[model samples]
Target chain A: MFMFNSLVENNLKIISKLKKSLARPDLGAITGTILVFLFFILVARDTGMFSLEGTMNWGIVSSQFIIIAVGACLLMIAGEFDLSVGSMIGFAGIVIAVTSVVWGWPIWLSIIIAFILSMLLGALIGFIVIKTNLPSFIVSLAFLYILRGLTIFGSIHSTQKTIIGGINEVSKGDWLAPLFGGKIFTGLFTWFAEQGWIDVFEFGTRAGQPIVDGIPMMIVWAVVLVIFAHFLLNYTRFGNWIFASGGDAKAARYVGVPVDKIKILMFVFTAFCATVFATCQVIEFGSASADRGVLKEFEAIISVVIGGALLTGGYGSVIGATFGAIIFGVVQQGLFFIGVESSLFRVFLGIILLLSVIFNAHIRKIIIGKG
Target chain B: METPIMQLTDIGKHFCSIKALSNVSIKIIQGECHCLLGDNGAGKSTFIKIMSGVHQPTSGQIYFSGEMTTIESPRSAIDSGIATVYQDLAMIPLMSVMRNFWLGRELVKNIGPFKIMDTKKCNAILMQEMEKMGISLHDPSQSVGTLSGGEKQSVAIARAVYFGAKVLILDEPTSALGVYQTEKVLKTIAKVREKGIAVVFISHNVNHALEVGDKFTVLCRGKTLGTAVRGKIDYAQLQYMMSGEKLN
Candidate 1:
């Protein structure tokens, strides 16, 4: 009886520790994401579409979404929204295309210029919002339209056309492209064109082939961003300030948190992430156009919400949002394999969004009741 | 007998056309719990705001440690060792107890270009402070949302104490608490006083005021009714002063 009682106590202690670990806001999102992936697998298996190849294909395609979603989560946690990410993607891609094709600029130089331009645009949006105290949604929405118009207008003026091809062909020829997106082990598994690079290490290859050996470069980027974001949110002084600003601006100001600077930094980071994803898209597709990243902002926001980030501000998790993006990717790819209509996929997505809102409300009720 | 740690002399505040606080004067001595008793709309919040530097007084000066000073903002108030814990407590419910404790002043370890939050240090300090206050927190990592009303107030008080607040202003700390919870918060107030920090206890509950207060100031209609030493006045006198009765 004493032994049994000791065993029970040990189990209770383990459960208590697990509960404490899972009490984080991001835990719900992570668990929900795992469930989503599991559902994807079930659907894939039932449809005879489950395969390692299929998983790799979806992973490559979803990497961009995952990366952008990390930044979107940060912006949301800081209590703001950036509606211009979709347009910013197109703008960055176009900048790369114009510099490389029209100006005959080096690939490296084009990437640098495009990145700088995207960051500057992000900073401008942030500056305006901070100066005016206007809603970020309204400001970013306006910037979205403005950038969209500019992308189309620039396409018309520079190339005398809206669609700019040759990026795919150029990517195939460039040494940098193969470094970013080359195949490994011949044809063991066709890796992401941009994530197949080999990095030197003392023992052997530190970074492996995109698909066969290990995680993709894009996924690596996403993970790095997530880790940085986690540190920023949990450990950094600025991170606390961001939470305080979002939680209660008046209280944050009362406690001397430099709320305006945090909000502005968030806005800039959102655009910068869009730019990074845009570069990845261009490298992968080898093309640029006004419609390169249509409705991407919606995807980012959906992923953030699905990951369990609060729309009201003061709460979010980069890891959760990344998983949320993966969930979207799984659903998108899994539905295709199941022969579900693309339009039906949208309907499913909408239902998931609504369900997540309901789930959030329920969780809040439980938390408040327990508290 | 000695000069008070904080002295408010003829502090007045006007909101557009409404005189929210007019000619309010009070003194808070070190290690003494000063109670400000008033009903709703009696300028209790307004007076506290001025004291905490949320609003600049329309006319008059504040004296911190007996020297006349200007408190332009909440930062200045915090710098002057004055911390205000309001009824809502300004805490993020989803945040961990330790994070909430060190929200504005996080302990950071510099790593090259980056500064990382030292969770280990924060947790250690939080546990030590909470233990010192005789409060047993089951988990420092638990979200503040999961804590009871009394626990939340205790965390706020402990946070202020940890930050070296010399004059702590508590706005109705026990109003939302149950009977036992109220006793818990009163004990926390007593604990703060024991740490040699001057406390401003603002409440409508005269019994609660009498329990922890060493000095009592009553406000009625945005004006000071009177300030009395705790032992000098009984509960009846405090009740009469708070309710607009003229004490002969």
Candidate 2:
């Protein structure tokens, strides 16, 4: 009888400890990502996605989603949303292309100007939302159109067409272009290929091009941003303010938190991130289009939600959002490799988002032990 | 006699055409729980808001420590060391105790351009402050949502006191608590009183008011019915005054 009692006590302790650990908001995102990864690996082990080149392709795409999702996560943690992120990408792309290619401005200078303009627009949106007491959804939805219209209009005005080409041409010989767009570690890959470490292409080299190319600049940017955002959110005073502002703004204000300022800075950071994604794409793709990054705002928000961020605000992690982006990229490219149509990716996104909300709610209820 | 920390003289408030408050005055002193007793909409809320600087009186003067000063805004009141813990307690339920305690005024370590939170110090101070209020927390990292209602109130009280509040205003802090929690909160109030800080406790429960209050002021229809001392007034008399009845 005493032995049974001790066994029951030990089980209770384990259960309690498990419950406490699960209270962390990021647990759902982490577990969901692992399940999804295992599901794909089991079903598509023979597909090209298992290959290095195929993995790199999805990683590059996921990088774009993660760059913006990190920003969306921070803004969501601060209790706001920015639907204009997708449009900001297009607008910033047009601004850089027009300034550098059409107006003969230096590539670096054009990028800086576009960045400043995006931040100013962000500040303006934050100001209107705070001063007029309007929901950010309504405000950013308005900006979505304003920015999209300006992008298309500006492209036409500058280049006399909807698309601005020759950015790669303008970027040639510019010292700053390669850092933002070009692939790095090419020499290392070439050496590895020569040493027979990686299999060469059966079709042989095209004009002596190495089979294993270096990593894309976009991937580097995404990684650096994810780490930086994680640090800021988890280890900084501003991170506490974000959680406080989102949790309960009135309570936060009662404690003397600069709720408005934290929110405004979050908006600005979101815009800046969108601009970074645009910069990399404009330089890498060697052109800019007014419709580039269409519907990307929805994609980023979906990733953040999947990463365990609360829509009501005040709880989330950047690492979770990064994993969410990975889940998206894997499913998107994996579907194609499995011969499934890519349009169904949206259905997957919608379902994942809905399920994540439900899962997060359940976890919170368990941790809080209340309805 | 010691000068009152805050004194409102003949305060009246008019919201458009309706008179929310009229001819109400109260003096709060150091190291005392001055109970403000009233039923719902008896101008207790209006009186508290005025004291907290949420609303400026349309017809009266406010004196702080014998100085004629007007509290123009909530910011001014907080800056002057006047903290108000509303019925809701003004706490972020989703945040951890340490984060919630240091929400607005978080301590930071400057590392170049970045300012990181000093979590160790924050958690230590939070634990110490909460313990001094006679509430021992197992882990400061636990979310405030997991705490009981009365514990949450104690946290809010402790937070206000930690921020150098000279006058602490609590609005119906024990209304939602159970019998045990109510007892705990009442004890916490006594602990706060010993720190030489003035407390303006608003409650509809005559028993609760009688327990911790050194002086009790009853309000009826936006006016002061009467003020009574603890030993001088009996429970029946205090209850009658709260019910808006004349002793005679």
Candidate 3:
């Protein structure tokens, strides 16, 4: 009888511990990320998806996604939506290109002006949403269309076509271009090449060139943003307010938290991040098209949701969203490297999003029941 | 009277032509649980809102710590050491107990240029305050939704006391709680009173109020019926007064 009692007690303890761990919102996202990464690494081994060069290719793409996803994750945790982010990216890129190329403005000055204008528009959206108390989904959805239309109109007005080019040429002599968009760690890569640590084509015109030359600026920006956001969400009082405002605005307000202010700041931050991504991409690609960044807002929201942030708001981790972006980057690049149809990528995204929602809901139910 | 901590005199409120509260007066003394009893629509909510600075009374005078003061906003009221624990307790259920304990006025330590929340200090203070309320939580990091309804109330009360509130207003704290939870909340209120803070307890249940209140003020139809000390008025008289009747 004593043995039976001990066994039951031990089982109860184990169950309680598991419940405690699962109660954390990030657990689902972490599990999803691991499973996806392992699946890709296993299936695409022959495609060199695990190679340094392959990693670099996906890393660059994922970093761009992470920049906006981190901001969207924060905003979601504050209980708002920013469907305008994708359109804002396109709009910001056009603004940067038009000012620098069409108007002969300095690239650095155009970048600054574009960022400030995007932030102002973001603040306006936040103010209107707060004042009107309308659902943010509806508010941002309207902005999505408005900004996209404006981008197209502005591009036609400036370049006469949907595409605007020569931004790379325009930024040739600019001092900030190298810092914002070019490669870094070239010296380290060169040392690695000298030591024969990097892969090289055995017998081709590109035989002497190392496959992994240097780390791109995009990856660096993404890493910096991840670290910065993690600290902001976990260590700051503003972070607490974000959770509080998203969790229960009414309750937060009663406790003297500036719920409205936190939410407005979140909206503005999301816009600023969209601009950051636009700036980086414009510098790297040397042009902007009105159609660029199409449907990116949905991708960002999906990344945030997969990162364990609830659609209803009030629980998420920047680290988890970073993993979510990694998952997206892996799948996107893995398919191309493995000779799968590129269009099938969207199908994978849809499935992952659906599965994440179901898994998160199941985990929440268990935690709530046990709690 | 040792100078009542807060005094509301002839407080009146009107919503257009509708009178929500009128000529309501109450004096709250330190170390006392002054029960403000009223039936539904008896102006209890309006009176508390006015006291908490949610609304401005059309005609009234408020005295705080022996001086005339105007509570222009909820933030100002909190700054002036007035804390209100609403029916919902104003707590985020998903947040940890420690986080909820220091939601608005979180303690921060500056590291470099970043002002980060001092989780260590928040956790320690939360545990200490909760223990003083005669409730021992196994883990301060546990989400508050896991706590019993009575425990949530205790956390709210303990948070208010920890913040050095001179006047704590509780709005129907036990209305949704079970009988056992209600008992626990009443005990917490007594403990808070022992700390020498004036408590404004709003409730309709005279029995619950009598269990912890030192004095009682009954409101009916936007008017103050009367006030009585614990020993002076029995439960029968309090119930009758609450039911819109008066004794000769």
Candidate 4:
């Protein structure tokens, strides 16, 4: 009887715990992830979207979003926005391509230079916002136009065209290039193909190559970044400072928190992530386009919002943002698989974003009201 | 008699033509609560800022432990064992109680070459410290926003005491609390005083001040009306001192 009573008490505790967990900000993203995967699995299952190669395709697409989403997630939690993220991507890619191809510099040197310059621009924006007391949204919006204009004009002036090619050939054997542009586990995939588990090319120039070679570095970076950022925000002192800096800058300052420094560093990190994305894209495409990554900034913010971060700042999770990116990637590819118009992707995003926001507001109210 | 722990002499502040504080003098003693009472626009906050190093007095001399010094920033103030709990409490509502307890000074455990917050030690310490102050938390992982107004005040006070605060300055700690919550905070202040820490309580509430304060310094138009000890002053006298300083 005593043992039975203890079991009943444990069950009651878990029920109360479950009720409290429902108010977590990340609930929206977890729920969204489930619904997205379920809808796609039912509709696109027979289209081979779940196959190894097809999954890889959508997973890479998700990684592309995850890269930018992670940076935006941290900065938004620290109470700022970087509208220049898309433009920064285009600008950083142009810098790499022009410096490496047009200026005849080494691929490794060009990559380092592009990263440094983009980060410096990010620091400049942070300084301006802090010094002038201007809103980051407006300041970054200005940089959005400025960086985009610079990318187009600089590309046309240096190469006489908006598209610069030959980076693939230049970065082919560079020491640092593989970090941004390669696959892992090719041998494992080959073995899987040998076991007749994965599809293999039967009639190509060189046969027996698995269709899904290995996990791309892009996905690896996404997963690593998600884990690293989640740990940083949860188990580090710097994480608390970020939240405090966003929650109440004045109060934080009174308690000896360096709010200015935290904000500036977040800006630099955002630019660094943008450059990483740009580098990967340039290597994969073998060229850099002036208009590449247009509207990516909005997509990243949408992902963060769907992940349950308030636009007002100071509450979010990197894992939730990752799920939001996965939802985006799956829906983008799944609609194509199920033979739906691609334009419905945007419509779906709008509806989902609206619903997520409403759901998040409800959760927030519950949290603020009682539990 | 013991020399005051912190002494501010004729401190004055001005923003161009408008003077926020003209002439305010006070001496904070160790192991006692010094109440700086005033009405709205009574320069109470400005005086707290000056004492807490948020602002530099345009004209005055600050003496600490009988040695003249200058407090140019909040960081220097904290380094000198002075911590301020503003009306807003300097807490992140979304963060856990343990995180907020050690916001700027997190206890970290080193692993290899990296440093991360020690969750176990922090959770234990937070619960122990809060319970010592008469508030037992269910868990350290609870969000601070879920706490009552008075409980938040106690947390700030507990944090200050834990961090080796020799002088704890509280701004309007009980102005926003209910009767029961205010009683809890007053008791906490008394408990802090017992630990031999000097407390500068800034408030507009006369009854709250009279309850926990040993010394009362009334301010009117950025100037001190006078300073009186608890046995020599009553509630009506202190209330009258602030009533005449009302700004319309």
Candidate 5:
């Protein structure tokens, strides 16, 4: 009995230490997302509609969301928002399509041009936001509508309503497609193929496939961007200055931190990420449209808030925002597979968003102690 | 007595319609704790704000080590070897102790392009500095939020001292601390003085001011009541001047 008691005590001590170690600003968002994912799986199972293929498809769709969500998270942590991200994506897609198809430019040149254009747009937005002293929400929101209108007008006035067919066939089978959507899964596994256990699950074992590259090239992009962002935030003096600037602009200035530069960088980075995500979408669909990224701004904001970022500024994490995006993706795909009505999914999404906001508020209150 | 490291010459400041400070002059010598005592809104904050370069004086000038100069901003003050530990301490609680210590003026391996925070060196230096101050910090990696008020204040002061601040301006370091904690802060202040830095101690508590102050200046209603050496005045006299009451 004494030995058992000691064992229990040891386990309790280990758990306590683990809890202490995990008590970071981002831990709530990360754990909450995992819990929600588990709940999603359970709900799918209870509804008797759970399948591996459904999960893979959800993963593909989520890849883009995750990438953009990371950029949004960085902007949010730096105490700003980019409402133009959704529009930026559409604009990037149009730029790529126009350059590659209309101008007869090589795919590489078109991609380079798209990146430069997006980066320039981002820098412009950042400059305006910093110079005017206007709230980023209002500034970016204005950009969102303006960009959307421009995209629609630009697409309509173009020679073609739609640029159909994949870009790989026209070129020498560029490796960009495989880089973006290479998959690693084989054919479906049935109950007979599993040889027992009711074929409850069949793991993906394929190395790489085409058509969105099987892995959603966007995820790789997101991972790369997130790592870069993490380094910027945690390792660089500029990154530290960014945190300080967002934490308290007035105080940051008093301490000699270049507040304007940090704000400008954040705005530019947000738009740049948006462009990258848009390019992925264009490549994946082999088409471009004005309505390509409608309402994505709202999704990005929701992801940041759900990831446990403080809207008031000075606190947040890229990883937390990534997890928040995953939660969003799971709910989106889970609702579809559960045979729920599309409108009902919207209602559920609203509830999730509301709950996430409330959860974020509560967690913030607990962490910072009511101020 | 050592020469005054910093001297104020009839410093005055005004805010559009009101005079926040009027011809206040005082002197702080090296290795001495000069305390400024005043009631609420007695121009004590304004005086220190001007001294710390938070506000430029409307009239008069400051002489640092016998050189006349005008401080345009807080950055200028820091550049001139003057650092202020404000009431809030200007610290980010979410950040680690070492990070807070090295905020703004971080110890970077390189100057630009390839510049990065020297975390190992910073942590080591921080631990050594804290130890030298006789502070028993369990972990330099701990968040500043987890520390006591006095510890946070000590960290702020140590940070300033480490960055080569010759004139340390502490704005009520012990105001938020309890008895034991206040004692800890006082000891830290003494340690700073032992390093040959002039300390401008601002406080409402006369007893605390008396404990560590080598000289005392009383201000009331934007005017200097009087200045006295430590042994020349008592707490009662200082309190009377601080409250705008004429001493007998």
Candidate 6:
């Protein structure tokens, strides 16, 4: 009987420890990521989905989500939302195309201008929200329309058609384009192929070349953004001000925190992320299109929510958002690999989003329950 | 005679057509807990706002350290070493106690071009300060939401004191606390006084006010009823003034 009592006490201690760790904001995101990976590994084992090539394919897709998810997570934590992110993407892409292809400007100059313009627009959005005291939701939503409208107007005014091609042609040999469009570590991959470590092409002019030559800049940006965002939120004074601003603006002000400035900066960051995404897409597709980023704002928000960020603000995790982006990439590519109709991806998104929201609400209750 | 740390003379505030406060004057001295007693809607909030620079008085002059000064904004008010801990306490519930303690003025260490928050040093300082102030805090990472009402107030008071608040204005610090917690906060007030920091303890609780208050100022309907030192005016008279009843 004494032995049984000790065992029970040990179990209770472990349970208490588990409960303490469970209070993390991204508990749901971490669990969901594990479940997703396990499911995909079981079902898509024979489909080459875990192969280097396949991994890179889904990784690229996930990288796109992670880039924007980082920005959205920060903004949400700071108690604001940027609905104009999608439109900003389309608008930025057009700016690049119009500047480089149409106006004969250098690719580097085009990219710089795109960033500058988008950030200014973002500042305007933030300024209006603060001055008018309107909800960020309404202000950004209005910008969503204005930016998209301006994008279409610019496209029709310059290129005379919706799509503008030749970025791949014009961007070649440009020093700056490669940072967004090109890849890195080809020499390492070649060594791996020579050592019979990776698959290599065996026919024609491309014979003996490694199939997976290098990591794309897009994926590199995503990884860098995740690391930077994680460090900023966890190890920076600005991060504390972010939590303060969202937690209680008036209280933060009383304590001398500049809530308005931090909020406006968050908005600018969202635009900066959107521009980064636009540049990557234009490089990858070798073209610009008016309808490029439709509904992307919702996707970024969903990824953040799935990562366990509270929509109400003042609590979130960058790692959680990264996993959420990975979930998007894996599930999306997994469905296609298993011979399932890709359209079911939308259905999966809806269900997962609902589950995540429910899970996040439960987490919020537990956090508050401690009080 | 020692000069008061802060003085407000003939302060009046009008919100459009309504007069929130009129001809209100008060003096806060060094190392004294001055209680501001008033019933609801007696211009208590407006009075504090004017002093804290949240709202400028339509007619008034503010003298700080015996020098006439204009506090144009909350930032300037904080710069002048005047901190107000309102009922909300200005704390983020989701943040750790240390983080909330240093919310705005975060301790940062330089890394090349970047400034990173020094979490280790912040935790150490928070523990040291909490211990020094006699507020028993076990973990610096414990969320403020998990703390009891009195503990949260103590955190706010401690934060104000640590940030070098010469004049600390607390709005109903004990109203939401239980009797035991209220006593704890009163003890904290005494601790602040020992350090020579002037305190403005605003409350409607006459008994609580009588316990810690060295001087009492009464406000009734946007006007000053009277001001009295603690020993000179007994509890019954202060209670009557708190009820907004004027003594002729």
Chain A (alone) TM-scores for all candidate structures: 0.82, 0.94, 0.94, 0.94, 0.81, 0.95
Q: Pairing residues by index, what is the TM-score of model 5?
A: 0.83
Q: Candidate 1, which segments miss by more than 4 Å at Cα?
A: A1-53, A103-109, A127-134, A166-217, B110-114, B245-247
Local accuracy of candidate 1 as per-residue lDDT tens digits, A1-74: 99999999999889767655544555666787678677877667866445545766677666778878878888
lDDT of 4 by residue, A1-371 (tens): 99999999999779757756976777888888898899988988999999888899899999999999998999999999999999999999999999999888999999999999999999999999889989999999999999999999999999899999999889978998888888888899989999999998988775888888888888988888889888888888998898888777877777778999999998998899889899989988889999998999999998888888878787888888889999999899899999999998999999999988888777665555353
Judged by whole-model lDDT over C-alpha atoms, candidate 6 comes out at 0.90
Superior candidate under DockQ, 1 versus 4: 4
Judged by lDDT, which candidate is best?
Answer: 6
Docking class of 2: medium
TM-score of chain B of each: 0.97, 0.97, 0.97, 0.96, 0.95, 0.97
Give the worst 10-residue stretch by lDDT in candidate 6 chain A. A362-371
Which candidate tops DockQ? 3
Comparing 4 and 6 on lDDT, the stronger one: 6
lDDT of 4 at A28: 81
Model 2, global lDDT: 0.88
Kindly list the per-residue Cα lDDT of model 6 for residues B179-201, writing each as its tens digit.
99999999999999999999999
Error of 3 at B187 (Å): 0.8
Off by over 4 Å in 2: A1-12, A199-209, B111-113, B245-248
Writing each residue's lDDT as its tens digit, candidate 5 over B29-78 gives: 99999999999899989999899888889998899898888888899999
- Would you give the TM-score of chain B in model 6? 0.97
Worst 10 residues of 1 chain A by lDDT: A193-202
Candidate 6 residue B22 Cα shift, in angstroms, is 2.0
Fnat for every candidate: 0.57, 0.70, 0.63, 0.62, 0.28, 0.65
- The model with the greatest TM-score is 3
- Candidate 1 is graded, for docking, as medium
Runs in model 5 lying further than 4 Å from the true structure = A1-19, A36-56, A98-114, A127-132, A157-216, A369-371, B108-118, B178-180, B245-248
**Candidate 2 collision pairs:** A257-B104
Which of 2 and 3 is the better model by DockQ?
Answer: 3
Of 1 and 6, the candidate ahead on DockQ is 6
Tell me the tens digit of each residue's lDDT in model 6 across A124-210: 999999899999999999999999999999999887888998898789889999999988998999999999999999898999999
